[model samples]
Target chain A: MVLWIGGRAQGKLALAMQKWPEAKILDVSETDAKGKEELLRSLEDALKDERLVWNHFHLFVRRALLLGMEPSEIWEKVASFVDERPDLVVICDEIGNGIVPMEPEERRYREETGRMLCKLAAKADCVERIFCGIPVRIK
Target chain B: MMILIVGGSGCGKSAYAEKRIMELSLDGAMRYYLATMQVYGEEGRRKVQRHVELRKNKGMLTIEQTRDVSEALPKMQEGSKVVLLEDLGNLVANEMFGEDGAMTPWEIVADKIVMQLRQMNSSLDHLVIVSNNVFEDGIDYEEGTRDYLRALGMVNAELAGDATQVVEVVAGIPLMVKGKE
Candidate 1:
């Protein structure tokens, strides 16, 4: 698993595409996976392919939180999928840089997203941070 | 040498920048803290005060120039070796929106800021600039906020291009994006 992290519109997706042109690009942002079972099923299906670009994995966390699903539980499902697929590339935007949201749920989403990204980054075979469309391999 | 230190809010970029500037300074070399923020209320005042306290006994002078940053250049001492501009976000915002609440074209503001920063870099021995990662939030702000983000994004790109070194501090960990120590 290769974890690609960057700020919004920093070309994380473009880099992923450039690296894996023939890979399946599954944008989690467009996924309507509301409940845990739906999300797990969607993720499992996406990972079944040879190479898959999971764009906006952060949005999955947001959706999970919206559906009152625990972040750890979501991570468990994601971890299992990642463990099964070595050709998975997860792209996430770094959304924890801004001011903390005043809304409680928004704040929780940010925190959960950050934690999930960290865990993924630690376990991934490679981690790259994109800044201004420049890819820097951090791990 | 111009160093650009970037990071998220309260991620220790300021503290790290301060230490870096101090390390870069020579004995008897003049140091200036170019404060770009304009205090609006009690919270702002308290934040400024905290920064002031942090820099106390650091042998550095604070220059408050909310807008027209280049104007501060002429006032700097001849022996000034290092100047740490604590932020570029507030500077860009102030230039776009004046004290009287007038809005200026963001392109012009961004250009002016880049030009001013270039001038500062040319004049100073070591310039340590601090900037924030303003664009990662998914919230679709109003048009004005979006414009501000675009402007800031442009400014940051320019700064990074011109900088001799670029570092992003995350959780107090400085990740070198460009250039060596």
Candidate 2:
């Protein structure tokens, strides 16, 4: 799987679309997945094809935090899916760079998202960071 | 040449920018560190102190200019100079809201910064700017916060266009987003 990570509005989804024009693009940001399990199930079905684009995967992390789901548990499920299907393309925004949120839930969300991104980057065959519409291969 | 180094907080963008400046500086080339942050309280003071400690003995002359970055150009010597502007986030805030709590239009603030950056680029031997990545939080902030972020995003895009090299530092590793090296 290929992981594309970068700051918000850095053209990550646009680049992903350009790369996989024929793939099914699923934007989790617009999805109605209320919990981790539902999100994972939807992602598993989406990854059935040879090329599938999962945009804004960090939104899933946010939902998981809201549901009080453990990041490790979510990562385990995601790792299994990626292992099962190697042609997935994941796009996520790097959201942990700003000032620490004052709210406890926001803090937890940031921490969980950071940890999950690290794991995704580690497992993905390719990792690229987009900045100002420029894609830099990180791994 | 202009180099833009951007990243999240504590991602080592400052350290990387400083090292890049040092490498670009030659003998007798004046090294200036343009500090754009105004230390407000304990947290701000500690952050500034930590940055000072990080650059200790680096032969840098720190120029504390919270806003009006272009004004510092006259103070710099007329030789080969390498300047590392620590950040654009605080600079944008300072420009948007002044000392007396007056608000400048966001477009003007972005324009002013971009103009200053362009001016600095033409004058200096090497210009390395450090900026924070601020737009990834999923929450919809208030109108004021949203305006600030929009202005910052505009400024960063302009800087990236003018920069000869753009690097995003992650976990102390410099990833080149544009240009070679």
Candidate 3:
């Protein structure tokens, strides 16, 4: 899997689109996957074909968390989906770089997002970090 | 030489900075961790404790200076060759809002901080600064927050230009934005 991660407005989506003009784009930033099963189903449908760009994967994780899905459960679904289709590109915003929030739920969401991103980075075949519209490949 | 590390909280910026400073520190050279956060409540103490724990056994001295970045210089002037400023956000906040901080305008605050950092950097062989990426949240904050952001943005821009290395840590991975390996 190819993973593109960066802060908001760093042009991760733009870079991904430019790099894979022929790929199908699936932006789940506004997805309300109410539960683990729904999220997994969405992922399965999205990863049915190769050359797919999964945008805002981090928000999907947050939605899953809010819908009462544990981090392990979310990771299991993502890992299986990506393992089945390794030829996919993912773009996620780096959300854990700001100050920790006062709300406990926000803090947990931030932590889980970062943790899951690390796991994804480890499994990814190519990892590039976007900064100021520039791509820096670290893995 | 100066190195700047920028990232979101818990993104392994401190870890990366610590490891980098350790690598840059020569044998027997003094190392100082310039902590800029002012501990107050339980949460504050816990955060400081966590950082202290991280630096445990790292053979580095810890100096707490919440405001006036240059004030910590005298204490480190005694042969300290390497220093790591844990962060610039808190330092900026303290200067802008702290009771004993400089209550001047954001531009003045930014100038003061940049000047202090330059003075401090001039005396050290290596200075590794850890800063935040607080501008991406897209939230329209209040005037105070905007001012704080402006000051931090200016300081980061100025120092980054002078830094020999600038890295943004993402999930424990360091992506070099400036300078070579």
Candidate 3 stretches with Cα past 4 Å from truth are A1-139, B46-56, B100-103
Highest-scoring model, DockQ = 1
- What's the candidate order when arranged by decreasing TM-score? 1, 2, 3
Query: Compared with the true structure, what per-residue lDDT tens digits does model 2 show for residues B78-160?
Result: 77888999789999999998778778888899899999889878998889999988777656577777778777877887788
Per-candidate interface DockQ score: 0.25, 0.24, 0.08
After TM-score superposition, what is the CA distance of residue B55 in candidate 2 from its true location, in Å? 6.5
Each predicted model: what fraction of the native A–B Cα contacts (within 8 Å) does it retain? 0.33, 0.31, 0.09
Predicted structure 1, TM vs. truth: 0.66
lDDT of 2 by residue, A51-79 (tens): 78878788877876677777777787778
Ranking by DockQ: 1, 2, 3
- For all candidates in order, the CA lDDT equals 0.83, 0.82, 0.82
**Candidate 1 overall lDDT versus native:** 0.83
Which stretches in model 2 have alpha-carbon errors above 4 Å?
A1-5, A9-92, A95-128, A137-139, B41-57
Candidate 3 lDDT, A1-139, residue by residue in tens:
9988876645567677878898888866555666667766777777666589999887887778888888898888889878887798888877775567888888888888889989999999999987645677889
lDDT of 1 by residue, A15-119 (tens): 678778898988766877767678767776776677789888888888888888887788887888788887788888888866788999989988999999889
Could you tell which candidate, 2 or 3, scores higher by TM-score?
A: 2
C-alpha RMSD over true interface residues, each candidate = 2.8, 2.8, 5.1
The all-Cα superposition gives candidate 2 an RMSD in Å to the true structure of 5.8
Root-mean-square deviation of each candidate, in angstroms? 5.5, 5.8, 9.4
Name the runs in model 1 displaced over 4 angstroms.
Answer: A1-3, A9-92, A96-127, A132-134, B41-56
